[model samples]
Target: MASSCIGKTWCSSARVGLSLSSCVASVAGKRNRFAALLQREQGGRKVSVSSSVRSQSDPIGGIQEGLVCKPSVVTGVPSELARSRRRAGRTSQYRFIMAQAASADGAAGVDSSATFPTVGFLGLGIMGEAMARNLVKAGYDVTVWNRTASKCASLATEGAKVGLLPRDVTEACDITFAMLADPTGALSVACGEHGAVKGLGPGKGYVDISTVDGVTAMKINEAVKATGGEFLEAPVSGSKKPAEDGTLIFMTAGDKALYERASPALDVMGKARFFLGEVGKGAAMKLVVNMVMGSMMASFSEGLALGDKIGLDANTLLEVISLGAINTPMYTLKGPAMVKGQYTPAFPLKHQQKDLRLALALGEEVVQPLPVAAAANEVYKLARAAGLGDADFSAVLETVKSHSRGSTSNDH
Candidate 1:
């Protein structure tokens, strides 16, 4: 029998001379061995093999169906395999079946390759652009779109296909991810006219990685599910540098199956992911996290301002804080530049303020008091009023310093 592995599971045979039934019996007997080998090769990941092998003999075509070998879905199989696939210039799903078959029966045959799913990205802002670029670099077939249109040009030059509209990109890809700036942009791109929902149906998934309220996320989820498509709210926890470095932490919810389907892509874009259950949960978790962050930034700014006002060098204060128990990466990263009055936006002041506002509203809805976050929101508002809204959130230090100077003037 002349046989070849097809897809990820089955084997197809062209009748020639060997005993096909005997071969199937032998392979079936050694199914446990195959499973063990696969598990060992895959770093202890569970591998389940199907027991029954059904075959149909085609008398007219002289072709016989070979033994069936189906394995459970395996993921996180190390990046080395992916890198090898890329280096080999193969765009299909690589399986270990061919090698195993060759070793089992010494029947060397061609194995068919399965192509990777096409991915689509909407919005090309700082976060989205970096994320989409990483996907393209990872050998994914990526299509991108942006409202500005020009923003898509840079990614396009990096081998990403440009989409004319959100709908166009969704229609062309199996899974689509959106990283819009705020709730309004996220909703508009996902549910508005010429939006992603318009092009979605069964077998398509939409992952919203934008920061939004739970209500907005639920609305988007409803719209996506209404189209027989899958939705996952995957707001991230990181700023510009993390996005650029592909180390953003994903807080995901809604559509468990979609989460599984989108894991490989998410793995490419984020360092870690937490599947939080249902659509609103992810959004709520992100809001709470941002609320705490906003408050912390406010406190850090106040500390820096107080140290400067009390005859202390700001950098020296930073070093002292670094050695203390209260030290954090946020302070370590933004303290020096902030002390020198340089605040290039990594996470924009306006966006951080927006997140704080949304978080306060969420707290109100749940009848929970968030006084510290509310106070932080006021500081962010003051900074925004002082025209620091487009700067980094760390620029709130300037607002703190300005207030301290005003108090000193009044005291004099």
Candidate 2:
């Protein structure tokens, strides 16, 4: 096993049919493949050095930058031994190799094992910033980039490096995580002239944790795959509070191998994870859950409105509902908020509306009818129509109330 390093990031490349333990060893020592090669030149040939090149274990014949070398042979080497091999002076081969090592992390090639790879986080909004903080707190070397550079100020003090552009992020980190507003926002930073895709290659991984539709996710997946980077769709449930608390549930889908590689990071950002098969499953699951939530909120609205007209105290009604078989955490969380008229955005109306819209499209694709979900979608549409798109989705009750007063049509 051989471990290589590019800058501070560790990259491991392993040859086929070799034990992974061996690859883990090659890249584990302080003296990386390049450093070992340099030492051999100064040791006057008694070192009997193995292949000085980074291993090409990838089936595609080459490894990418920031990936540790997975050596064909796996043997433990002591760090003290690596540190003691300092030979200074006149080997042209040593100079040539140092030049190669200097630019290895910058190019799309195999990496060294001496350092931890940097992680680049894009979007520092409510969710993005929290996710980045968790990564930093978990001990990942992190770099951040946000459209509003001011958004990154808080994280910079937490030992996070801030960069100016998405391309800079790619150049700095081995893996990049994106938590943007939607597909448009994700694509804006991921594709085009100065986007991340330009810097992505075989050694890079891009995880999109945004809530885009399955189709949009597929398009993004295609874009990332075309650039030789691994892509994963990891839409999440819960909102800003869950994100901050690190309890967001990830509905992930993509290459299972890549998912395994990222499980450590995902575990840091979320409490639970569900690998739902392909690229679209995570998006599909998010849409399904949101559709149910939207519809349930709509139903709860009607129930509460009727209870109101019948002279029931909304608070007591909520207490009763909370005790009954109909109780749900969603009810508990939103009931008091609704009762107090505190409809601040946790999950904004526009995003919920987007989820419903995507669910409706998915339903159409599968030829499945979702009348209740359809009805809920209509309520959200009405909420948006009422200029409440930026409010919490619970504000849909306003539309329900207005409709109850015979102010509008519910016809589809």
Candidate 3:
């Protein structure tokens, strides 16, 4: 055998054919190629270092930071030395590099050693973090990237690789999922410099789960297709808790092949997923769902306010509604919270307003009359203007209460 090792592999030392590297050391008659690179936890996002020059932590898990790995050439090393190095643990400056692999964790997750399509996640907000972690727990090799790198540190510990740009994730993985804040952010990350479009090519998939308008989704889809990459717009229906529990509802469209290929991953992150046949359809479905949701919340708030003014208890009103024909999970889940004056934002008021605004505009463009949705949009806007934009959508109760007070003062 040739003496030189190639990144932890024994190889011909002649520096020809396929084995040339800057990392090798030998003891006695043995040579091993050592690699020192940071592997992040499952929900992490980007970290690019120049020769790891900016790496703040040591290679070992024990030290929080300050681990520097500089490669040095070594000649003549025995196999026993390699065995000793393995036993030395993470504290050793030089660790043996093994082939990239992942192990399957039954049907739910994958281990880091088994060979599967590497997954990439962009944006590590609450929803993104939760979704990415589910994939990690299912045993898939995931690479993550976020605008705020600090949010990704914990995921790095769970065996995720950090990426520096939207394109980095696209180039590195067969499929990439993005869960950004809004349509603007989604478009920027997908089409801007170092965006997903730059890295996407044939055989790659880009799945965006952001709640954007159909026009926005279609635009992104066109950009991805221009790069010969598949695109799927998969906007979800449930909120934070559902995302965390892997019970979200996925409304997906565009690129049937990509949809089929992403089924395993989608199954891991959602309870049910619908393939709606086209990119804009999925976006439209999400908007319609939210539009109905906003109208229902606005109506619910009005009912509660009216019941209160009639000296009926809010809880009693909720109980009556819960048993009525129109009762829904939204009423069941948010009723008590609304009654108790607690709005912790399962869905923000501002987002609801935005969705309603979009749905109304969509209705207008299609020449469909949506007086109820239009009215609900105004209430949500009123709530947003009342400084409840960050609060839960149900906080529109305050908007209702303010209106009621104004009505009473006018009556006096």
Q: Residues 1-412, candidate 1, lDDT per residue (tens digit)?
A: 2123232233433221223223323453445544454444455554322221112221111121232231111221223223323322221112233223322342333321112357899988878999998887655678999999999889888899999999999999888999999999999999999999999998789999999999999999999999999999999999888888778889999998788667767766777778999889999999999999999999999998888888898888999999999999999999899999999989999999999999999989989999999999999999999999999999999998998988855585
- Residue ranges of candidate 1 with Cα displaced over 4 Å: 1-113, 409-412
Q: Across residues 1-412, which tens digit of lDDT does each residue of candidate 2 receive?
A: 1223322223222231223223223433323543443344445232221224333122111123443333211011112112212321122222223233323432445442222346789998878898898777644578999999999999999889998889888777777888888778877888857888777877678888888888888888898899888888888888888777677888999966567556546655776778899999988998899899988998998888878777999999999999999999999999888867778888888888888888998999999998989888888998998999889989888888778787445654
Best by lDDT: 1
- Model 3 residue 103 distance off true place after TM-score fit, in angstroms: 2.6
- Error (Å) of candidate 3 at residue 177 is 0.5
Q: Per-residue lDDT of 1-412 in model 3, one digit per residue for the tens?
A: 1111222323222221211122222211112212222212111222221322212232212111111111111111111122223333421222212211111111224332222467899999878998998777654678999999998898999878899898998888888999998899999999998898899998788999999999999999999999999999999998889878778889999998778667557756876678999779998999999999999999989998888888998888889888999999999999999888999977788889988988988998899999999999988888888899999889999999889978854585
Instruction: Please report the TM-score between candidate 2 and the true structure.
Output: 0.71
Alpha-carbon shift of residue 334 in model 2 (angstroms): 1.0
Superpose all Cα atoms of candidate 2 onto the true structure and report the RMSD in Å to 1 decimal.
13.1
TM-score of each: 0.76, 0.71, 0.72
Where is model 3 poorest over a 10-residue stretch in terms of lDDT?
67-76
Ordering by TM-score: 1, 3, 2
**Prediction 3 TM-score vs. true:** 0.72
For model 1, state the Cα shift of residue 361 in Å: 0.3
The lDDT for every candidate, in the order shown, is: 0.74, 0.68, 0.70
